[model samples]
Target: MNLYQNDDTTIQIDALNMLKLKKNILLKGPTGSGKTKLAETLRHELDRPMHSINCSVDLDAESLLGFKTIEIKGGESVITFVEGPVIQAMKQGHLLYIDEINMAKPETLPILNGVLDFRRTITNPFTGEVITADDNFAVIAAINVGYVGTLPMNEALKNRFVVIDMDYISGETLKNVIRTQTLLEDETLIEQLGKFNKDLITMAEQGQISEEASSIRALLDLCDLTTIMPVERAVKRAIVDKLEDDREQQAIINAMELTF
Candidate 1:
């Protein structure tokens, strides 16, 4: 979480400046644009405890709040309280990160609505206590635009947050990532990979390709593994293989062919 501007000339983030905002901000961008990483960096700078939940189509209110659990202690059935990430965040005053918030079921919005408003409290069904949010509790949700099959967040829930449309990462940032993450420190290769990934991202933006567009994560993961294995094999497994067989995958493979 402690990420400094490793190179002042390249990295754009000033975590201290971001943590100073009064309201919770929704970070919107395309895939692999460093949204989560930025959140982690800011969390460290603010010295805030974090509780994150990755939202998918299946997430529901019960998933957001605490649930009932049965435990066997001394051969006796002991009913225990099991809290979800949201409830835990509320209790600890941690920075709650809901990754891909838009992907959560529409029904879940009502639960979030209560938490987001000034009457910030969550009711634990088991405990029967309407717990209030700690003064320091902050929500940082990340979302993607133009992803098919994702449920659009309801207007009411959206109204609660300050939306910040995030820009695609600059070439220099990619270079910095490459230099730090990849095994080959050759400035030429680092810049080359950055440009290649940038081109892939562009193709995805233009709707010229299918699997989720190449991410900063894809390049970083590739770089991290390439030192221990062949780059081609690493990319094949770490990226191409992970993607579903879709138009995006073809476009990405085509771009890779052109680049390397």
Candidate 2:
């Protein structure tokens, strides 16, 4: 749960400042780059309850707004309206977290135009209720650009927030993250794993491997597996086997061999 911050990086500070100014935040980063972690951190620091929505192509209006469900009351069936994350967060004046904002279908996102803008209001299509957000309601959205199945964010939608770019942790910061997150105690082994992660990241950047294989979350999983199994086996299960392509798997295996 820890996000290692280098001395030179003011990511958390800058993000807090933006939220304090009532500006929505758009976190742009590669997968597993701690965008969601950063959002959670800001929510905790601001002492606001957060309602999260994981965006994907399958996301729809019912998920964003609310749904109606039938229930029995006094032996009679009654239909009740359930508020979705967007409406709940607005009404409660809490933090609204939209993870992978660009993954939702393009046509579905226009529903948030008024909610994310200066108006801060959304008319519930299902209930025909015009809900105005509380003054303290804020938004924090994260995106992974250039990934498969992710759509380009509309510029009009993109212009509504302050954008922050998050990148992978490296060197001592990454080493510390591994040490803190895993049961690994040996400094030498931790350093080796850190180097291996950096190498995989390099390969991913060069298009030799997918970004998912180089993720810090995957690296953490590998480290945890090493506690119960051999590093080689851990690499195969945690990093290598996750990719279906033979060439990519072998590329990871080669890196593992070179590193170990």
Task: Give the best candidate by lDDT.
Answer: 2
* Backbone clashes in model 1: 4
- Minimum summed lDDT over a 10-residue window in model 1 is located at 1-10
27-117, model 1: which lDDT tens digit per residue? 8887777788778766876789898888888887667886888999999999988888888888888888989988988877677777887
lDDT of 2 by residue, 154-239 (tens): 88899998888888878887787777767888888898998999899999989999999988779889989998999999999998
RMSD after Cα superposition, model 1:
3.6
For candidate 2, the per-residue lDDT at 240 reads: 89
- Candidate 1 wrongly placed segments (more than 4 Å): 1-22, 73-75, 181-184, 211-213, 244-254
Q: Which ten residues in a row have the lowest lDDT in candidate 2?
A: 1-10
Q: What is the TM-score of each candidate against the true structure?
A: 0.84, 0.91
TM-score of 1: 0.84
Top-TM-score candidate index: 2
Looking at candidate 2, what is the lDDT of residue 145? Answer: 86
